[model samples]
Target: EGYGLTEASPVTHCNPIYGRRKPCIGIPLPDTEARIVDLETGEKELPVGEIGELAVRGPQVMSGYWNMPEETEMVLKPDGWLLTGDIAKMDEDGYFYIVDRKKEMILSGGYNIYPREIEEVLYAHPKVKEVAAVGVPDEYKGEVPKVFIVLKEGETATEEEIIAYCRENLAKYKVPKYVEFRKELPKTMVGKILRRVLAEEERKKMAEAG
Candidate 1:
């Protein structure tokens, strides 16, 4: 996923998944450079595998954050790093991993939950043809992982079975609290599953029930 920064300049990260594997943004392109900064102090680099705001500085980096000088100054550090608002981390293999869409990381009971992990487990089920995981508001846990699934043709896996599998493969905090079976997934033209769309539908149903 090549994220565009206005004109699509400046850095951060890019994801190029060639298959069903959890894709990583590979090394920089020609003349492009990037770094991961601690989300708090914005100084120093976290070891590979730690998540943080991705910053970049290279020929392709934008000059500023548009006309928002204050915002620009805040993002484009005096040291020439353009703090792309995206959150990510690099791997030991020098590949970048996006944590969330800045807006999508779920803060539930003081824990930051990323959806990709749960989605990965769901993908492991042979019966699951497709799935999407999203966060829904929860008054108790603050938020919870909810999964919407599309099973493979003639295949069967109950919602409880799916949750049990997740509990086996994931942390207690990471297992989805809700599950839904779908006939077909809402997808982008390019075939990307849109979790946000399913989340909206889940919200509508929850609202109706109330």
Candidate 2:
């Protein structure tokens, strides 16, 4: 049960007690109209169950980003729709699911890969305590998913083992090409994984290697 933004007066949605999906952001709050639009254009509304950028309109939304007109215009449309950067989809029942951050999606061999989908598969493994999937540069594919995992206490796993497990659970292109074992992951005070920090580190290492 969650949905919020600095520009949306905070919460725009919440899961109800009777009908709710576990880990979902839930349905749009009262008076808030939500829609999923094309990720590239942000104009065409997508059909149900189709993943796209989430947009919302309501009284709670901010007028503009405090004189940052250009920045405000990018997200806050003239028609009162706020084009949220989050990738999401709506179910037939009207529940909303956050796919991942729009920028976090991977473009590999012309296929769109969502990091959250891969992370979900990794989380199913018994030894995994935490995991973050980031796109790394791949000469042939443009980019490939690289997973960094933190193992649970007293647990041990190998790169081959983890990759093999993923291969069995995910499509070939969606399988991570690289697996890194980390003692701990960078995070915010509230425990949100800092994936951008991990992406930066991967780029730095690749640059140095090149």
Q: What tens-digit string does per-residue lDDT give for candidate 2 at 77-111?
A: 99999998999999998889999998888999999
Please, what is the TM-score per model?
Answer: 0.78, 0.93
Per-residue CA lDDT of candidate 1, range 1-210, in tens? 554365235434455445332466666555667778887777888888888877777766667755789877777778777776678888776677766665566677877777887888889888888888888978898789989898999988788999999999999999889898889988899998887887788679788988
lDDT of 2 at 88: 94
Query: Which predicted model would earn the best lDDT?
Result: 2
Q: Candidate 1 at residue 69, lDDT?
A: 92
Count of clashing residue pairs in every prediction: 2, 0
Candidate 1: regions farther than 4 A off: 1-7, 10-23, 40-44, 64-79, 204-210
For candidate 1, what is the TM-score?
0.78
Which candidate achieves the best TM-score against the true structure?
Answer: 2
How many steric overlaps does candidate 2 have? 0
Off by over 4 Å in 2: 17-23
Q: What is the Cα-based lDDT of residue 188 in candidate 1? A: 90
Give candidate 1's root-mean-square deviation (CA, Å): 4.4
